[model samples]
Target: MASKKNININLKVWRQKNAKAAGSMESYKLDNVSTDSSFLEMMDQLNEQLVAEKKEPIAFDHDCREGICGMCSMYINGRAHGPDTGITTCQLHMRMFNDGDTIFVEPWRSKAFPVIKDLVVDRSAFDRIQQAGGFVSVNTSGNTIDANTIPVPKADADKAFEAAACIGCGACVATCKNGSAMLFVGAKVSQYALLPQGKVEATERVLNMVRQMDEEGFGNCTNTGACEIECPKGISLENIARMNREYLKASLIK
Candidate 1:
C-alpha cells in the first residue's frame, strides 16, 4: 500500500564491514518516500538506489517479509524492531514514520550476539543456550499417545502457549539496558516447564539453560520490564518469575 509521495527523510544506519571492523552510523537521504512501505521495503528501495549508483548496498537480514520468522531485527528510532507493538521488523510499516523524519537503524547489540554485517548480528548464542536443554528428551519410536492421556490444566496450557510464542528475535536482549536475555530464556523455560511432555526434565532443563545463559556474558535481569514492553510477542515478566522458581527448585533438587 506504500505509494511514493513527496516526502523526504534522513537515515542514520550502522555500517560495518565485518565483525572486527569499527562500526559507525552512516547517513543517507530519501526523497519521495512511500508511507505504506514496510521498513525492510524501504531498505530495499535504498539498496536499489545504491545499486544503480554502483555503490555498496546496505546489509540487513530479512525473510518471510511477514513478522513470524523473527529474522528481521533492527533498532529503529531507539526501539527494537521499530516503534510498533506486537510486531517484528518486517511488519513495521513506513506509515509509522513522518515526512522529514530522521530514523536510526542498527543491529542487535549484545556481547553474545556479535555483529554479522551492517544491520545483522549472529544470534546463534540463543541456539547455544537452547542446546543447553530446551527440549523434551525422548527417543521417537512412532508411538502416538492419546492427547487426553496426559491431562494438562487449561491455565498451564494457555501459559505454555503464550510462552511458546516467543520467536527468539533478541528484541528483549536488544531493548534491555542490561542486555539481559532473561525474558527470552524465561519464555523458553516457561514453555517447557508448563507442558506435560517437558515436566520430566523441567528441573534439569531450567538449571542447564540458566547456567548456559549466565555463561554467555549476558547481564543479570533486574526486572525493568522493558523487555516485556518491547517484546513483539508480549511475553510477560511472569514467565521470568516462573523461571526463577523453576531454577530454585532445580538447584535445590540438584
Candidate 2:
C-alpha cells in the first residue's frame, strides 16, 4: 500500500567532441529518477533532457539491454560498469545509488580504447585483437563434424566452455591501472587452446594474438588481478596463466 519515491541525482559526465578534440566533465542534475530503471535507461532520460533543451545529447554505446553485448562501456564512479561485481552497466539499476548521489560517468579509460564522445570509446581495438587469432581454421566447410561426436575430455571441454563465456567488454583493461588486457586475451587464447579443433593453431594463435595485443597499445599484465575483479563475466586468472603458458610454449618453438 505504498508508493516508492523516485530519487534525484547529479551526473558528472565526460564530454568529448571527438577522438581528436579536447574533453571535460560536464555536470547535469536529474530529478525523479526511478530506482527501477536500469543505468542505461537513466542515461536515456538524460539524453532526452539534453535533446529537449536543444543541446547535444550524451552518446553512450549499448545493445541487448540484457547485458550480453557488453556494449555499455560506462565507467561509473571509478569502477568499470559501475560499483558492482558480475554485472554490466546495462544491468545496473538506479537503486544502487542514493537520492542525492553524484555519479561520475566516463568512458573505458585505456590507450587502446580512446574516447569517441561522452561515455563512448573506440573499443575497436578489441575487435582487431579478436580478429588476430580468436578462431579455428578448421576445414569443416563441407564435412562439418558433430561437436558432440568429437572425442573431448570433460575437463577440457569445461574449461573451453568457461573461457568462451568472455564477452569482450574491455572492463578488464579499464579497471587495470596498467590498462592491461591479459584477462580478455587470456580468455580468447584459452577458449581455443583447450579445444581439440584449435590445438593445431595453438602455437601461432597465442603468438599472433599476443603480438597484436601489444601492437594495439594494451599493456602487459600487471599481476594485480584487477582484471579478474572487475570482469563482468568473472573470467578467472587461470585463463591468464594458461595463456602465459601457451605464449611461452609458442615462443620456445624453434
Candidate 3:
C-alpha cells in the first residue's frame, strides 16, 4: 500500500454536457495527491482544485463508494475501472499510479447509452431492456413450495448464481470495440434461464430480451472477450455462449 504522502499527476477527462452536445477531452494538472486514496477520492481532490480556480468541476457518477453498487463507472487509461482485474472503479487505489503519470478518464461509451453529462451516460436503456422480459413472469402465489420440492442439479444452481452476480455496471459495453452488450444481456438471460422457475417462459424471455437489446442499437457480439475482461463481477463468456444456445433453441422451436 502506498502511504498518504502527496504526489503530483496529470489528468485528461472527457467532457460532454448532454447527448446533443459535442464532447471532447480536457486536461488538468494536480499536485499533493495522497497515494493511499481511492480513485474517486483522487477525483474529488481534482474537483476541489477546479472549484478554487473558478472552473467548472469535472462531473462523474458514484454512489456507495463500496464495490457493491457498481455505480462508479470510469474508463481509466484505456481500461474500464482502471487497470485492475475483477474490481470496480471504487476499489481502484491511487497507489497503482506513479508521480507525474498521465491518466485518461472517460464515461461508458455505447450508442444504447448516450451521454447525460461529462462522465455520466444514460444507462437506463439497460433497465428498459430488463423490463422487456428479463425475468420470469410467474406471480408469487401464497402457495409456498418447499426448497426440496424441486431438486435442481448443483451445477445448474451454481451457474445460475454466477450469472445472477451481474451488476449492470456497463463496463462490458464501454470496453467492447463494437459497444455490444451481449455479456450484460446474456448474464440476465442465463440467470433466469437456468432456473426451473424461469424455464417455463424461457423461449419468450430470450426472444424478447435479445430483440429489445437489438432495438436499443447495441452492436452485435463478435466474441472479442473484452466484456468478460473488463467486467468487475467477473461474469463469464460461458454465460454468453449459454444465451446463444438458448436463443437458437427458442428460434428453432418457435
Candidate 2 structure quality by residue, lDDT tens digits, 1-254: 01355989999999999989999999999988998899999999999999999999999999998878888888899999988899999999888888888999998899999998877888888888889998988676898877778799999999998889999989999999999999999999999999888898999989999999999998888699988988989899999999999999899993
- Pairs of residues clashing in candidate 1: none
Candidate 3, poorest ten consecutive residues by summed lDDT: 138-147
In candidate 1, stretches whose alpha carbon ends up further than 4 angstroms from where it belongs are 1-6, 144-148
Where model 3 places Cα greater than 4 Å from the true spot, the runs are: 1-4, 141-149
Model 1 lDDT tens row, 77-146: 9999889888999888888887888999999999988998899999998999999999887766789675
Give me candidate 2's TM-score against the actual structure. Answer: 0.96
Q: Compared to the true structure, candidate 1 yields what TM-score?
A: 0.96
lDDT of 3 by residue, 1-254 (tens): 44447778999999887778999999999998888889999999999999999988888889988888878898999999998889898899899888888999999888888888899888988998899889766556977676567888899999999999998999999999999999999999999899898899899989999999999999999999999998999999999999999999999998
Cα error, residue 223 of model 1, in Å, equals: 0.9
lDDT of 3 at 57: 89
